[model samples]
Target: MKERIRWMALHGFISGVSKLGARRGDPQARLIADPWVRENPGAFADECRKRGSLIRCRAAFLTFDHGVAHEVLRSDDFSVLEQGSNLPRPLRWIAKKTDPGLLHPLRPPSLLSVEPPAHTRYRKLVSSVFTPRAVAALRERVEQTAASLLDDLDGHDAAVVDIVDKYCSRLPVTVIGDILGVPDEDRPRILHFGELGAPSLDIGVSWQQYQQVQAAIAGFNGWLAGHLRELRGAPGEDLMSQIIRASEEGPRLNEEELQALAGLVLAAGFETTVNLLGNGIRMLLDAPEHLETLAARPELWPNAVEEILRLESPVQMTARAAVKDVDVAGMRVQKGETVIIHLAGANRDPNVFPDPHRFDIERDNAGKHLSFSGGRHFCLGAALARAEGEVGLRTFFERFPHARLAGSGSRRDTRVLRGWSSLPITLDARDAAMSSSG
Candidate 1:
């Protein structure tokens, strides 16, 4: 009880300081804590711009300027210390005193939190398996998976189907799971892991949410350990098997690193792809003409997918911490301070993209958007994500060209990710259309 109180007091003090600093009206002191940002991030980004390109939100700096955000992302002066590096001194101490065993188990950071030789090594290991060629080889499987998902929708008696649940949510998990050699019977459990594990990445997860994250990590680790043990002894034609063989052949990953890599692949693969599909469908349905254009010219589906990413990026924001004092966008960001990169805002920057608010599927430069991020931290799964998004969109439109919005959609309650929680859509059945024609 005493430990919990101390922890609460420490967090309360931090929040108090954040609110106090925000009220000063300093040009660099805009608060992103406004709950409204969750619902309308673009508006929040505009507010950040009004304050200055470089502004403070709690302990972090925010930049809506495209150039500044891009530069900070690529800059060696900034690092990803706060996100995935070692836990802070206070948190480490608290965990040590409160739950010693859970402390070490919870503290091992993923690639998102590492730096230097370690980051390079981890990236190389992952890239070896998650290659563009590998993703390309899986294209047929992705297409097949999309068809199966839509076919399930067709079997439903209800005309209005939630695309998020029926297609967007299922396809990516199934694809990633298949690639990882997850057993058919265990697929649902892994999918649940991705769902419950997502909140772990949120900046302001509640106590209950934090507990959920820990539970997910513990559960996943236990499952992965058993799976890896089996794969080590008898390798198969799967990504996990390949990783196990590589670990045995050369520079090896410790048990913790192995588990972390598996979990990363599962969670990251599931979350981003789910959002990409949801966002693309919402955008196309909003402008039915674009869907028609894609259906008519299948070749343009790739460009259409790119434009959707630019307009409604799946991952809205990322952050980097300064390793040393540096001037960015005319503000001196001190060492250990963080800069929040609003990828969605930067994608919409008018100077970088003319008439940015307008969604143009034919926008020639749509490929230049920072949706996949940039520099060293560029998403390793970029090629896979693109392939998934393109194929998923193309197949969906081709299968149900007359699909339309049946009801109001609801957005996910996520501050950093933009996607739909429930997107209700209705597809036209061929028999019904023929009956109506008669």
Candidate 2:
């Protein structure tokens, strides 16, 4: 009852309001309430872009402009508020008192949910985990993992396979699991936990959704607690063990902070990368010209990954709240107001990329994308994700040059997290398979 009451006060209330506004043809409302609108957000983004760089919506200030989004994300004036922290004092107290003690993705202590000092400390400690040298070292492992996954698909021969379930989802989770010292058996559970808790990253979720995600969070939290205990008892050479040693010996992290950091690193390590692989696969298959170009000029794979991230951003939008009264694009956004930055829109802005809708692997400024986000809270796992995406997609295509999408696959249901849920792919025995099999 407490959970439901608190949820109703926040997520439920926003959901109901958005639905009502959707009926009145509000763009922001439809953007939230209408699934179709979100899946095809370019038109909606264009509408917002036409209005201005920043427009006051019924719920928050919105920005589709790349410059504005970049500024807000990098600016110190914005805060990544703890979930429900903006509510009335009494309600916030209720939220705090009723907390189920799960490590939620969008709540305090999670790197994505806290302001500096805490965020800075967490990022600084974990920063070594994905340094360029570390990513380069892990590249070979990612390549081997990708090759092994692609090899497993050989049994299908001429049959159509759901690559998402069979490969895309497996590669990153497995690799990241190794990095985190999670056992092979536990990786699938981690993936399941990620999938279930993914919608937790979004706002205005339904009451049932809130319940389901909370339950998943509970499962994840319990499993993680045990895993951390196991790691401490028998520390491994993996990064998580390093984090444990550092936290204990360095500026000491509390139990919750440690759990939050571990959970975010593990989840963030694979979730978006999975989306990146899935989206990259679909993009490469759809645009064979780019694929052919990449085949000839394999050096373009990294830039191609950037273009994929820009064209089909794994994360569509992010929000930041004003810590003080600020003037944005001539609009006075008072203190405490939130601003939604359409990352996808920014990637496709005409001012930035010429022929923005077209997928051009040769595009010069492809790396300028805000897909991994920007500013102090920029994605910590970006180097790893980039390595995984480049290696995974390149290896998959090189191994199965004859691969094609067998059918139109289903996309992930959440608006914030974007990717194919079921990508039916068919691959014939390509020439590259002969040497490996021989």
In candidate 2, how many Å is residue 376 off?
0.5
lDDT of 1 by residue, 1-438 (tens): 753443343343343454566577432233324455667666766666777677765456778788998899899998875332333577546645665232122134477777778778777887788777788877878989998988887788876789998899899988888777888788888877667676555543455655676677677777878887877878788887887777667668988787777777777788899999999998888898887777777888888888888878888878788899999987888987878788888988877889887889889899988988888878888888888999998888888888888788998766667788889987875555676689
Clashes per prediction? 1, 0
Q: Show the lowest summed lDDT stretch of 10 residues, model 1.
A: 100-109
Clashing pairs in 1: 84-113
> How does candidate 2 fare on TM-score?
0.95
Ten-residue segment with the worst summed lDDT in candidate 2? 427-436
lDDT of 2 by residue, 184-244 (tens): 9898899898888878877788888888788888999999999999998999988889889
lDDT of 1 at 221: 73
lDDT of each candidate versus the true structure: 0.75, 0.85
Error of 1 at 424 (Å): 1.5
